[model samples]
Target chain A: MIMLLNECKIEMIRIFRNPYFVFWSLLMPIIFYFIFTKVVDTGVDDQELWNKHFLMSIAVFSVMGSAIMTLGIRVVQERSEGWTTWIKVTPLPSSSYFIAKMVGQSAVHVFSIIVIFIAGIILNGVSMTFVEWVSSAAWILIASFPFLALGVLVGTMKRVDTASGISNIIYLALAITGGLWMPMEILPKTIQLIGSWLPAYHYGNGAWGIIRGQFPEFKSIAILTVYLLLFMVLSIYIRRKQEAV
Target chain B: METIVEINNLTKEFKGKRAVEDVSFSIKPGEVVAILGPNGAGKSTAILMMLGLLHPTSGTVSLFNQKPQEQKVRERIGVMLQQVSIMDALKVKELLALFRSYYPTPLSMEEMIRLTGMQGSELNRRTDKLSGGQKRRVSFALAMAGNPDLVFFDEPTVGMDSTARKQFWEKVRQHANAGKTVLFSTHYLQEADDVATRILLFNEGKLVADGSPASIKQRLLKKAVSFKMDGHFPKEQFLAMEHISDVSEEKGRIVIQTEDTDRVLSSLFSIEMPISDIAIDKGRLEDAFEQLTVEQGVS
Candidate 1:
């Protein structure tokens, strides 16, 4: 327990200190929120509904960015730099290291959510009941699991540049198709079709559902769960394959 | 007495190419052993297998008479890999504390500092921001933090300057004196000769030689008997002798290359003319290392 906590403390510090985490997860989502709600004037007839929906979109966006970029890139860096090799020889078990990363990155995801949530309130004077606010945050945090798993897949990459490049591509694709930048109705049919299978789309939908006083769709929950397991299994399989050599 | 480490027929292959092949050795307690080899000579692979970082293709490694992966074995060892792989964004002190928490019995923070010669300000500074030498010191401290009974260092001084290098060996010697079994890998023959009680020389993924430093040098390196001749010398007589490999005059001195310098010296005394300033040169470890690796292809 002490070992896990110590590892977690360092992991949290490392994630929070990262400039990429700050720029992509916290700053970018807040920027996008303000641009859409305050300036871009997303051409929806029901502006109030759009405001609440957009707020949830960006909040989910914030956590997903942290989950993928921060977790993925740092793991790759550690692998290439040989920190993984050093730690293995210590008495610290691999499970402790893994749990620490999960817990620490989850904390970063929460921080990103709150920062973007505050930004949403400031941008449009958006008002909601305390339950709506808390539930939206909770939904986004829980929905970040699949993205975190995707980050693990990215972590298995051999080089940081490849991890960074692949993650950016996935991030942009997730944001665009998931309706975080625009409403799902505005996207092309093919993209929406692809988005339906992506955890990021369901991630935003769940948060948006919470803000609209509706339960997150059971289908969305199940799909995100499947993705989480899929990525987790993939990461394990690839890691084992790498080690078998 | 039990062996601290035992490897039987250990081998590792990457993509059908041999990285380590059918090699075996055991380590005893309180022995400072150097795994001396050129780069890509399977030094790191063997160490990784012993540390349980890399699985062997065939065979096994046991530490403290238990599998290397056993928690009981893990708690008794520390490692500093060839690469400087300390976690970035952590204070040096934080890393030490984190690694120390892994083992059941770890050195105190003050003791770690004293052992590695790390200062207070450096400890507080983040690891990524440290200079190369400082980072190595931090790595060394992390390796010692567990107060391990057995330690493995793979090319630990690759990037350190002279002072840091000197300090590193000093601390390593200190640990060895405390009766810890320390195994380090290096390409520097002089370092192996100077520090190790026993040297394991690897060539082309094979354990080419293993013995005391003196014995290895004596066995593989040629010695030279040289003298300033007092009169005309019978060079042909010396050259024709079975003990002498070559007899030539170098810088006005008769230099005789031979496997047995004592025999050459004895023969010199039998000469009619007296000799002055007689000297013998034991061949360098570099030659033996070169001889081993170059001859590996043919063997």
Candidate 2:
């Protein structure tokens, strides 16, 4: 367990050292929040709605960055460079190696969400009650599981070239459909229905609902949990097959 | 000494063609075994299977009487695969530290660096910045980091200069001195003759010969004897001797390949051939390797 955490700590350092991830996870969220809430503020009666919507959207974006894009790309690169096989030969238990990835991403997901939320408060004039803030943050962090599992599945299924292409498509689709790129209410009804089925949509909506002091939809949480389990199973099966080859 | 690895009728196929077929060999503790073969001779494939990176299509491979893929079993074996790439972005020390985390007990970072003869400055450099030979040295250090009892070096000295190659052989010897089992695969015949206690010759996916260098050399019947021959040399006469396998002439010199040197010499003396600068060349591992692979026609 100690060794596993050490590995995770090293991974965290490597991710922070990369400028690309830092831009997306830290700088982009602050920029997006500022533009949405401060610069493009369409004078509306309920400013609270705008605050909750964009804050939740930034949380959703955080999940996409840490859970999907960052984790997926790293796994593909590691496999291509034979680091996976190198790990397999070690005394480090395979389960520990895998669990460390999940733990590491969860930490990153929560950290990014907090940073975005605070940036919104400081720069975007976004404010919320203590209960609303706590629930919204908790929901976003809890919702990272499904995306992490999905990232592992896709990362394991393809090589570096295929993974990069597919990850971009998947990341963009989730960002748009999950309301990270736009307000969910303004999207087409067909897309709204499709969005409900995506883990990212549930994550975003759950955070959005929590920030409004409304109970999150239990159905979306259950559905996301199922997706998480399904992807984990698929990832294990695919990775074992890769090793067999 | 107990055997460290044993393979029984191991066979692996890709698509429909056999890569390694019905191969069986065993290596004992504190011994160095070299697998020598031409390209496409299935040497790398065999090593992969041994390392449990590839599953055998049929048959059994037991490292220390346990399956290679078993976690407990694998911990005892260290590998330097043919493809050597560390995390290019990580400094050498950082990479070593990460690999060290994987092992329960490992040599300290300082000791590992010292073992590989790496200077202090080299430890701080990123792997991508290192020269090819330096990268190989770092890989050698990583393989020994765990202080594993068994190490598989797949073409460990490939692309290395003469000095680097010599230094690597000394390391191999050091491992053996510490009672470590080593399975070295290489195309360099001299490496096998110099370092390996037993040479495992692979031809087209089968174990053709396994013995000490001297023993393997002696098993080949043909020897090359070269000398200057003078005055109406009865090339035909020497060629006809039943003991003589074949004879060839090269620019004022006669090279005879034969099993019975005395009988061939008797025939040559009878023909009144003046011989000067005569020397009997003991057959080498290179010659035996060629003869075996050519006869077998490694696919």
Candidate 3:
């Protein structure tokens, strides 16, 4: 248990020391929140309602981004750098290494979420009761689970450059198709259909449901859980294959 | 002597191409063993199998009388691979602490730093900013942090300067003297010659030669005797002598390759040639390594 926690502490230091991780996970997400909420006016008469919905969307986006892009890129880089082989020879179990990464990534997710929420309240004049804010934060945190699995899947990719490129493309596509940038009502019918099948859509929908004072759809939760399991299995399979090689 | 490591018919194949062929060896406690081989000779592959990082296609490896995959066995060993790039963002102290946590008992931080010769400021610096040699030193420090009973180092001094290499050998010697078993792989024949108690020469995925440096040199190279003579010398007479393998003249010196230098010397004195600058050269480990590896290639 101490070893696992030590690994987590080291991983957190690594993440924060990395300028790229800081930019993407903290700065870029905050920048995106400001641009979307404060600068780009949706002209919706219910300004507070628009602020609240956009805040949830960007929060989900940042959480997923950090989980997939930051965590996934770092894993692939470590593999390419031969750090994985070093860890394998140690008494540290593979499960412990992975758990450390998950915990560290979750910490970063919370930071990103809080930063975006502060931006919503300060810049866009968005208001919410303490219960609503706490519940929304909780649901957003829960919604990030599937993306954690996706990050692991991306980490198993062969090359760090390839992993980063693929992660960026996937992050943008998921955010756009899932109606985080625009409402699903505004996108084409085919896009909405495709987005419905994506884990990101469910993640955003769940968080948005919580913000709107309703329980999230059971179908969204179920779909997200299924995606999480699928990605987790695929990640483990690919990682085993890599190790065997 | 108790065997600390045992390998039986170990082999590894990657996509039908054998990386390590059927190879077997055992190491006793307190022995500093060097695995010497050229590139593609499967030195790294063999080390990987012994460390339980790679599963052999056939056969088994036991360390400390337990399977290599067992955590108990793994905890007793420290490893530094040939081509590893560590987390660049981590400070040296943080990296060492993380690796130290993996073992049940580890050396103190000050001891690890001192053993690896990591000085002040270097320990506080991030790994990425260190020079190549400095990074290699840090890697070596991490390997010794666990205070392992057995340590595996693959080309540990590749990027190190001559001074650093000397320090590394000294540390390995200290470890062995303290009853720690070390198994390392290197392309430097001189390193094996100077540091190893027993050398395992691998050629084309086979353990071609295994012995002390002097023994291997004796086995592979005939004694070389060279002398300068002022008077006329009968080269054919020396060449025809028993135990004399070859005789050649260069710059007024008669160089004789022979299995027995005593007989050659006796024959030379009996011939009454005015010999000057008589020098005998024992065969070097490099010659033995070359001949052994070349022989394996031909056969």
Candidate 4:
């Protein structure tokens, strides 16, 4: 556990030192939230609704950025550079590698969640029940695991350039179809149905539901859980094959 | 002495093309064997298989006479691959600490730094910021951290300059003298000549020759004899000497390519002319390797 945490902390330091994170992971989400909310205003008068919508969208963005972009790029680089092979040869267990990655992503998720929630409360004058805030933060952090596993799968499949491009596309697709960009209900019915099946849709909906003081249905949790499992299995299988080769 | 690594009929094929074909060798404790081969001669492929990074298409690899992939056996094996293996994001100290986690018992950071000759604020420097020689040395340090009984060092001194290379060899000798089994691969013949207890030549994924350097050199008994001779235009006499493969005269000197030193020396004794500055040299490892490789066309 100490090793895992140390690895995660080291990863966090790298993220903090990276100049790209300043614009992309930190400032970009808030900037995008403002631009999108202003350009498309749904006829909902309550300020709290806008706050909830904006907060959830930024939270999803944070999750996408951490799991898909940062994790994907780093993993691909590590693989190409033979860092993964060295670790495999070392006395370090493989489980520690994955656990460290997830722990790192978890740290990023927490930061993203807090930043988004605090922005909503301070700037948008959003009010949330104590239970709502705690539950929403918990769910946002938990949802990072599935996305992280999916990122690991994608990262292991392709080289760094392709992984970055594919992860970005996945992030945008999830953000758009899953109601982070626009409400899924507002889209065409077929698109809405497709959006419902997306993992990001379920994850975003789960977060939004928590912030609205509503109990999340098991279906959304089950969908994210299944997708997470599939990605985890796929990542493990690909990694093993890579090692064998 | 116990044999720590045994490879039996190991073969690896890539897309139906054999890279290593039925090559078998065993390494005993405290022995250092250098695998010598030209580029694309399957040295890297063989090393990869031995390190468990690549699986053999046929046959078996045993470490400590157990499966190579077995964790218990792997725990006693240390490897430094041909490529850079450190993460750029990690500081040197952090890197050491991280790698230290992999072994049940690893050398402490102080010992690792000392072994690699790194010290004084350099320990906390990020890996990417280090020079290539420093990085290679650090990689060497990591390879030694586990204190394994068997170690694989693949092209460990490639990027090093002469001074660093000498230092690296000293460290390698220290490892072997401490009773560790080391299998290192190098293209530099002299490096092998200086340290390797035995040298194995590989060509086209096959072990073409294996023996101590002296033994291998001895196999090519054709030594070169050059002498400045005076007072005789003895051309046919020298040419007719037994065991002399070739005779040539250039600028008052007679050069003989002969396998039998005694026969040639006796023949020269009969030449009553003054023999000045006579030099006889046995074949070198490089010459023998080139001759064998060329003869076999080990491409």
Candidates by lDDT, descending order: 1, 3, 2, 4
> Per-prediction DockQ, in order?
0.82, 0.58, 0.81, 0.57
Considering the two chains of model 3, state its CAPRI-style docking category. Answer: high
Q: Write the residue-wise lDDT of candidate 4 on B1-299 in tens digits.
A: 67787888999999899999999998888889988777777888998888777889997887887776677766788888988767876788887776776677787877888876988899989898898888888888888788788889887877677788879889888889999888988766556667799988887899888999666545544577888876866767767767877888867778887767667787778866578898886644344355343221112
lDDT for A154 in candidate 1 is 96
Model 3 pairs in collision: none
Candidate 2 achieves a global lDDT of: 0.79
Which ranges in model 4 have alpha carbons more than 4 Å from their true place? A1-5, A33-44, A185-193, A236-245, B218-299
**Reference-based lDDT, each prediction:** 0.84, 0.79, 0.84, 0.79
**Which stretches of model 3 miss by more than 4 angstroms?**
B223-299
**Which predicted model would earn the best DockQ?**
1
lDDT of 4 by residue, A126-173 (tens): 788888888888988887678888888888855788888888898888
Between candidates 2 and 3, name the one with more favorable lDDT. Answer: 3
Query: Hey, what RMSD does candidate 3 come out at?
Result: 6.0
| Candidate 2 local lDDT, B149-245, one digit each (tens) | 9999898876777787778888879878998889988765556777888888787888778889666545543577788966776777777677787
Query: Lowest-lDDT window of 10 residues in candidate 4 chain A?
Result: A34-43
lDDT of 2 by residue, A7-48 (tens): 777767677666767887788877877787778855766777
Residue A41 in model 1: lDDT: 60
Cα deviation at A223, candidate 3, in Å, is: 1.8
The DockQ for candidate 1, computed on C-alphas, is 0.82
**All candidates: TM-score:** 0.87, 0.85, 0.87, 0.83
Candidates, ranked, DockQ: 1, 3, 2, 4
Give per-residue CA lDDT, model 1, range A114-156, as digits (tens).
Answer: 7777777777778899999888888888888899999999999
